[model samples]
Target: MNPQHTRAFAKAAGRFSNTDRIDAVMLARFGALMTPQIRPIRSDIIRFANWSPPDER
Candidate 1:
């Protein structure tokens, strides 16, 4: 995993509630399991283009 992803996971893990600590653990586990396939964001323009205006059908 990249340092940015690892750091984000650490920050998220730190925010878990006491009763929901297991959910945080699960998030960490899933982050590791899924990180290998994660791709960098490509183009913001393409994303913006694909978004519809509020009045559009």
Candidate 2:
């Protein structure tokens, strides 16, 4: 998984109050119930190109 996805999964997991086993079960159930979304996959070059510099473009 990508860093963004990992972050998102962590954020989702953080929202729940449960033990690791329960969280794993919840994640599995959530994954099973949700339809997958297809997001655009950017290469490192594309990602960098899209990033604006702190001072200027």
Candidate 3:
């Protein structure tokens, strides 16, 4: 999450005080309002490939 956006949203909501409790509420509200889209996992991840050349085996 972007810190600038967080601060901006909190400030807009009249939550200038940056505290854990206040942040929790702000973030929860942000999530509810924004409903960010889910993305699939990257396909670049390593996978098992145990095969070797027949001659070498």
Candidate 4:
């Protein structure tokens, strides 16, 4: 889920303050209301696997 969108939604709902409590509520509500596409998080290992080492000079 997009944090910016969630925060913006919270702001639109008059939740001006940002706290863990507010974030939790906003995230839950956003997920429930928006039903955004879910995707897996890329790990650091996956990033390194996509890179190649430089050849010797």
Put the candidates in lDDT order, highest first. Answer: 4, 3, 1, 2
Worst 10 residues of 4 by lDDT: 16-25
lDDT of 1 by residue, 1-57 (tens): 565664566567674344467655756785766656756777997798799878765
lDDT of 4 by residue, 1-57 (tens): 777888788889888575888778778888899999988868987888889988999
- In candidate 2, position 54 carries an lDDT of 85
**TM per model?**
0.30, 0.36, 0.57, 0.62
Clashing pairs in 4: none
Best by lDDT: 4
Clashes of each: 0, 0, 0, 0
Q: Which ranges of candidate 3 are over 4 A from the true structure?
A: 37-57
Judge candidate 4 against the unseen true structure and give its global Cα lDDT, from 0 to 1: 0.82
The lDDT, on a scale of 0 to 1, for candidate 3 is 0.75
Give the TM-score comparing model 1 with the true structure, all chains together.
0.30
Worst 10 residues of 1 by lDDT: 15-24
lDDT of 3 by residue, 1-57 (tens): 566777788899998675899899998887788775656655554233544466863
TM-score ranking from best to worst?
Answer: 4, 3, 2, 1
lDDT of each: 0.64, 0.61, 0.75, 0.82
